[model samples]
Target chain A: MREAYHEQLNQLADHLAGMCGMVADAMELATKALLDADLAIAEQVISDDAKVDEARSVCEEQAYALLALQAPVATDLRTVLAAIHAAESLERMGDLALHVAKAARRRHPQPVLPEPVKPYFAEMGRVALKLAHQAEQVIHTKDIDQARALEDADDEMDDLHRHLFTVIMDKDWPHGVASAVDVTLLGRFYERFADHAVSVAKRVVFVVTGRMPGSGDEEL
Target chain B: MREAYHEQLNQLADHLAGMCGMVADAMELATKALLDADLAIAEQVISDDAKVDEARSVCEEQAYALLALQAPVATDLRTVLAAIHAAESLERMGDLALHVAKAARRRHPQPVLPEPVKPYFAEMGRVALKLAHQAEQVIHTKDIDQARALEDADDEMDDLHRHLFTVIMDKDWPHGVASAVDVTLLGRFYERFADHAVSVAKRVVFVVTGRMPGSGDEEL
Candidate 1:
């Protein structure tokens, strides 16, 4: 029974990792939709959200069953709990991607963001993609160092986010309220995407170290 | 051993309920500060956030210890797990309240929200307060119907949020970027506060029903 539970738990972890990949792809596609103003990709991201939700439900059910049946203790308990946490984080990531896609779809014909902010948006996209990939690596290898690196990478995205805000705040730009709203919303999406990735990294740290990282003394 | 574990689980639930009360009060204080533009109250909210965090940590540690030492299964396991979820939701509520307080402090003497929107803000605040109180009741009574009502109340906040945006968009609010940012952030705080309340309610439902509420529902 223990071996079977272990196998079930491993399968759940793999499913979570796979969901993260899909969420990462959704973010990538949503970012591209924003940059290229591709309505098709935007709609695709929005429509595909149900799949992510389904994956989350399955992962959650599996974790609950393992806890109920196996009565897992200590490390095994932490692993199951972390799987649930990771699944929720990934689900939220998918929702953030959907939010970005919805915003992109709203301003279909006209570009959602100004050309000046393109570089920042691109960098944000790259950073988010990297974080997502790193999260999957953490799940697969349970590598605390890789997870730590993902945490560090979020700082760069934060810097870029601040820069984007500065650009928006500049009086030189003749943009209207729509532009400001788009920029602010876009910044929020990027920041939250990074935050969810950090959450995943933190869970990985917890899984390996049996303690939550960045809880004290460590800069988050 | 089972009886002791059950007793510890009950104690954990009580602690979680206490934390929820703290969070609800913090949220109420923060909203009042926003509505009244009271800097002192906002500061108090900020200062009290550490206490909420501490409460959450204690609850988590207790739940973890119970699970590790007692290895609770079946209903006992579910009860402990629900406590963990409730702690996280309460912590998030505290954070949301802090966000509101921080935003309020930043805009001391908050410019009178356009007269037309004052009632909307008030209504949002009232609903939030009620939801917070309802969350406490749900915890105390383990009443699924009361919890469901809290979930339904979330839609009211959502409606108010939409109305707020509509008003902002309809009027040519001269303040432009600052006003828009302030209003948007405020709306986000209210929405998030309600979301946390609903999450707490969901946990309550989970505790009683032994299954999550709105799990497969995609209406949200």
Candidate 2:
């Protein structure tokens, strides 16, 4: 029974890592859909988001089962509870990706990113994908260093997000209000996607170090 | 031990209700700051966000202690786990309020909303505050009727949000791209604030019914 309990715990972590992988792929595809204006891939990402939702449900159910039947204590208890929070974060990351895809679908045939702003988004997507992959690794390894590294990578995303804002708000910006609005929202989606990835990494830190990374959602 | 455990559960519920009250107040003040360009009040909301964060930490700590010491099952278990999720939703709602406040501060001396868009924000603010209060009440009563009511109310907010976009994107829009960006992000903040309030209400329904309101974060 103890062995099975531990196995269940391991499976919980594995499930979280797998969800990260799903969102990472989702973010990548969504980014592609946004840049290339591929309606089909965007639609595919929108539909595939259901899988991430299912995985979140699975994570929560497994955590509940572990708590109810196994009553895991100490580190194990934290692991179960952290799994719940981590799944929420990853699921949010998936939604952020979906929003990116939706942006693409909304503007089908015409790319969401104008030429001037395309590079910023490309870099943001790269950083967001890297953060998601790091979140997956952090979940599996619980390596404090790897988890902390996500925060640093997220800084690059933040810079890109801020820079994109300047481009949209620039005096010479050719893309009028509509395009500016689109870029503003898309920038936010990518930034928030990175934030959720950092949030997932924070959960790993909480589980391993038994300390919070910051106050709450604002910081994360 | 059983009696004490149930008290802790009630405390957990009470804490959630209190946090909603905090955010409801925060949302109200933030909206006022946005509309009036009240720098002092905006600054107050920004500083006071820490209280919401503190409340969240306290709730999570109380929950962790409950799970570790009590090993509650059945509804009790659901109550504790749902508390964790609910607290997170409430905290994010607080952050949304903070973001609105920050938007106000960024454009201090100049109102964030252009004249035409003011009515829409005024309506959005009213609906968001109402939802927050409803969320507080639902946390207290676990009233499914009230919980479901929040969803219906949120549709109004969504319409207001959509309408704001139309106004901002209109060719006659005189606020230029900068104001449009501000309004876009502000609209998102308000919309997301209402969504979090709905999410908190859904947690109550989940505690009572063990069902999901939707797929995950996107729907929430």
Candidate 3:
């Protein structure tokens, strides 16, 4: 029974890693769709979200079943719990990617981004994809140092997010209110996507060190 | 042991309902701060969020303990799991309210909403607070009917959100990019708060009916 529980735990981790990969692909495709104005890729990313949702449900069910049957305690319990949360964070990352796709689709035929803010989004997209890949690695390795590094990557995303505002707030911004709203929401989507990745990394940190990363509190 | 488990479940429900009230209050104050430019109210809402976080952690710990020690199955398992999810949704709602407050604080003496968009935000705030109260009611009663009704309330919020965009997109829109960006994020914050409330309601629907609300699929 103990061996079976360990096997199930490993399976949960594997499932989480798979989810991370799916999200990374979704974000990459969504970013391309946003930049290139490719409706086909945008639609694909939007539709592919259902698969990520399915993956999350599968991971959640396995965790619940493990709890009901084996009732593993201590670090085992934390691992299962962390798996549930990490899956959720990954699922949300997929949803953020979907939002990006939908935005891309909404402004189809016409490019959503104006010229001045284009470079900022391009960099944001690059940072987002990099973070997504790192998020996957954090899940697979459960390395505390890598998990901390993910937070730094997320900080870069936040800086890029702030830079977007500076451009919009400048006197020369000629895109007007509609484009500003689009840019604001787009920057937010990428920033939030990175936030969820950091959250997944924090869960990994919790599993390995028995401490919540951001709060640095041992009790949680 | 069965009765003890049942008692803990009831306590968890009670705790979740309490969180709902706190979140409702937080949203109200945050909205007031945004509309009135009241820094003190914004600060209060921001500070009160810590209490909400503490409440969520307590609820989660209790749910985890129940899963580990009691190993509830079937409907009982679903209820505990739903409580965990509902608590998370509620906690996120609190965070959204905090974001609203932070935005309000950042703008300080100046009102975030311009004259033309003020009414839309006012209406959004009203709908948000109303939905938060309804969310609390649904948790306390677990009325599947009311749970479904909350979705309609959420639909109203979506409408209000769309209206903000229409106002911004209009040729007559006088606000510059800065205000437009602020309005976009503010609208999104309210929309997401309602979305989380609707998610909590759906979880209640799941617990009562053994079916997920949106998809009607038992697989989740």
Candidate 4:
């Protein structure tokens, strides 16, 4: 029974990693759509959201089943719990990507971004993709160092978000109210996407260490 | 051993209920501060956030210990997991109240809100406080009906948020940039506060039902 439970647990991890991979692809494609003004890709990201949603549901079910059938203890219990939390975070990340795609579709005929802002969005996308990949690694191998690195990466995204806001508030940008709202919402999406990635990393930390990061040290 | 675990689990539930009660108080005080522009009360809300944070850490620790030591299965596992998630949602609710209070403090000495918007702020606050109370009840008793009511109440908050935005956008309001930003952030805070309450209710539903809300009978 213990061996079977272990197999089931491994299967849950596999499903979570798969979901993370899809979310990463969605983030990459969504940003590409935003930067290139590709309507088809944007539409694809929007349409593909249902798959992410489905994956989230499946991951939750598998994790719950393991808890129910196996009655996971200690580290095993933490692993199952973390899988559920990570899946939820990944789903939200996918939703944020879809939001970016929707914004891209709305601004299709002309690019809303000023040239100076392009690099920020590109860098934000790069960091987000990297975080998602790192999250997948955490799920597969439970790599504590990789999870810690993802947390550090989130700070860079925050800096980039601040830069985007500074540019928006600059006097030289002739963009009107519509552009201002678009950029503000876009920055919010990137920030929130990074936030969710950080949340996944925190879950990883909890799974391995049995305590949330940044709280006083307590032995597992 | 099972009896001992049950005792610890019950104690954890009690601590969670205590936290919920404190959070409800904070929300009420924060709302009053916002509606009345009472700086002292706003300051109190900000100061009380540390208590909320401390309570959250304690509850998280207790819940993790229960999971690790008890190795609860089936319904027992669901209960502990739901508690952890509910604690998080409640902690975020406290943070949202602090945010509203901080905004109120920044706009002190003079009212940030115009007289016309006072009624909406009052209504929003009332609903937020009521939802927080309902979430507390749900936590204490595992009451599904009250939880469902809280879910329904979220719609009203959403309506008020939309109304607030409409008022801000109206040309008759003579809105300055600072006021617009203030109102927008306030509206978002109320919306998100209600969202956290809804999340708490969803967790209650999951705890009782052993499946996620909106699963639609889908297989894993």
Top candidate (TM-score): 2
Question: Which one is best on lDDT?
Answer: 2
lDDT of 4 by residue, B1-220 (tens): 9999889888878887777777778888888888889999999999998898899889878887887777787778888878887787778788888888887898897776877788988898889888888887887788778878876688888888878867776656554544655666677777778887878778888888765665211100
Off by over 4 Å in 2: A216-220, B216-220
DockQ, all models: 0.41, 0.66, 0.55, 0.28
Residues A1-220 of candidate 3: C-alpha lDDT, one tens digit per residue: 9999989898988899899889989988998998899999999998898999999999989988988788777789888888888887888888888888998999998889997788888888888888888888988888889988987788788888887889888878887788888888888889988888888888888888987766411100
Per-model C-alpha lDDT, please? 0.81, 0.89, 0.86, 0.79
DockQ of 1: 0.41
Give the 10-residue window scoring lowest on summed lDDT in candidate 2 chain B.
B211-220
Q: Estimate each model's TM-score.
A: 0.92, 0.97, 0.96, 0.85
* Model 4 segments more than 4 A misplaced: A36-38, A105-119, A170-174, A215-220, B1-7, B32-40, B105-118, B170-179, B215-220
What's model 2's overall lDDT? 0.89
RMSD to native, candidate 1? 2.7
Q: Model 3 in CAPRI terms: which quality?
A: medium
Question: CA shift at A11, candidate 1, in angstroms?
Answer: 2.1
lDDT, model 2, position A137: 92
